[model samples]
Target: MSIPAEKVRERLHALRSRMEKKHIQTVILWDPDNQYYFSGFKAISYSRPIVYWIYEQQTAYIIPELEDLHAEENAYTDSFHVYHERYNKGSNDTSFLDPFIRLLQNLPSDTRIGVEYEVMPAYVYQAVLDHGHDVVDIGEDIIDLRSVKDEEEIKWLDEAGRLSDVALDASFRHLKTGMSELEFDSYGDQAFLQAASEKYPEVVVGYENWTCSGIRRSAMPHLHSSTRTFESGDPVVHSRQVWINGYRAENERTFLFKDQATEEQKKLLKLAVDAQQAGMQAVKPGVRACDVDLAAYEVIKEAGFEDYIDHRIGHGLGLSEHEEPYLRFDNERILKEGMVYTIEPGIYVPGVGGFRHSDTVIVTADGSRSITHYPRSYEEMLIE
Candidate 1:
């Protein structure tokens, strides 16, 4: 397991504290991240029940029978309740439900159970209700518990950030005018993976790449990479998240192909950079999360590009690129130490290209640290 045992214990301790505050006796966890968090069991959801059931005294993984041996080798928890068709060749519909019912019935009738209501499967919900166990929503609490990264998690995230910086440096070194969007993305991912293999043997990098060449196409956010070729004077909006171990760090930049950029393109890029800088400057231990967005958005407004802004400054990044406590004008969640997020303030003009740079940042007691650092100077961003 990538996470240390001490770190795992810390996570459990925090979870138990939260559970105690909410009177939650047992927790039914189905979210994969939570599964990985509680136990060192890692499994992709494939319609099979891969649950981590948390009782007052013990934690257990309920997985498919085929995965029983795998869980034994990899899972930190020794208590595993497995179910399979072969094991119950002639059993009826009760085959899958029986074990869960038995597990719940072992607890007292008044035991206050909590489930991730937003992500809990309907079958799981029915099983809890059928067993007469009191289930309450603990979705937000679970998410909040994961917002603060521990020392081990911060180590993995920092490594992920450096790997992402390696990827960005590779992409800029090889970027050219005639390459297709697919070609650029493919080459960039391969270079990142290769660099990670040589530099950090323990880390693996992967991402979903979004690339667009020319102003017309770059105006559309989340544009899928196609075979579109980059012209001589085109503006390239290239963005990707390089995931390490399961932690993600974003690396994105707006590039100009020719030696010279138009005045409007330069202005857009500077405005975006200034806005992003303002957002980065606002990150601290006690500042409101929305205030960071306002600090960035105000730059765009002052530059007369307020209407061009469509999305928030950024969102939380961890096992997933986008998560809780999103950096928008309405979210009032206060920033805290150990909370990692991105500060990407972009502007998309109607007939011009999108200009933005998204970087991974970790909030500290004083200010913040840019874990993923790449030179953002115009000289470093020119393709020619």
Candidate 2:
């Protein structure tokens, strides 16, 4: 197994402890990430609906027939209740829900079950209810647990951060006029894939990139890379998220082409850089999550461009692209040691375009250290 057996046991122990405290006899995990967290098995796709069930004494998984061998090899579960699809496997449970419902019906009527309220499908939830067992939410407990990164998770984050910088360096090296957004992204993808293959051999590594160039396109926060070619004087928002061993590190930079960028555009970009610095500086243990957001927001507010700000300063980053305990204005959650976050403060001006630089940071015992170290300065970002 990629994850140490002891590490998986530690995680299961932690969750089971929470379950015991809440009198939850069983926990049904619906989210793929959550399932992979407890069991070391992560399928390429979840269209078959893999479900993880955690009980006091043991753990189990409900998966399709095709994944039976994969689960046996990777999953740390004690048992697997597989549903078949092929006609030759007749008389066996034909659908995922068939085994799921059977399991629910077998549970004691008075048993209290735990489930992810937000992600569990309505029909699946109703089936649990139909079984006459009491249900409670365990999503918050899992989120709380995952917010703090373990040493092993942190190690992978560090590697992911390093790989992200490598990809960004390659992308920036190839930056020039007339390159399509998709073409720009291809340079980084190829570079990253080559590097990962050379270094890690059989390790799982992947990335996602989106390049928004020009005034109108860059103004929008999230957009897929397209065939649109870059023009001179355009503000470009290049975002890249790299993952190694399922741990992700987000690195983004907004750069301006050396062609007719207005004075206002220069100021906005600088403001964004300054705001990101403040946000990064404010990330430390024992501080409120909102404080980090406000530190960055105050920078933008002082510059009278607060209206251009739309999203929060950042969010937690780990096994998932975006995690919980986000750095938002209203979130009062205390930042803890070992927690990972992305410090991304952005401004989207209608005419000036978007300016934001994101860096993944890990909260240390005293302060935090950024993992992504790509050149984000305005001078360096100006592609000549």
What's model 1's TM-score?
0.91
Distance from true location, Cα of 194 in model 1, Å: 2.3
1-384 per-residue lDDT for model 1 (tens digits): 456777677777888888999899988888887777777667766867787888767788877776778778767774877777664544332244566777888888898888998888897799788877778998888779888887777887888788777777777676777789888777777777887788766544567878877888877778899899888767788888887767888878887776555778877877887888889999999999899999998889999999999899998988866878798999999999999999888899877788888888999989999888888765566667
CA lDDT of each candidate? 0.80, 0.91
Q: Lowest summed lDDT over 10 consecutive residues: which window, candidate 2?
A: 85-94
Model 1 — which ten-residue stretch has the worst lDDT?
87-96
lDDT value, residue 184 of candidate 2: 88
Clash pairs, candidate 1, are: none
At residue 179, give the lDDT of candidate 2. 95
Number of colliding residue pairs in model 2: 0
Best by TM-score: 2
Clashes of each: 0, 0
Give per-residue CA lDDT, model 2, range 1-384, as digits (tens): 267788889999999999989999999999988988888788876579899999888888999999989889999999989888865775468889988888887787789999999899998899888888899999999999999999999999999999999999998889889999998888888888898889886788888989999999999999999899998889999999999888999999999986688888888888999999999999999999999999999999999999999999999999888999889999999999999999999999997899889999999999999999999887887777
Q: What is the model-wide C-alpha lDDT for candidate 2?
A: 0.91
Per-candidate Cα RMSD to the true structure, in Å, reads: 2.5, 1.0
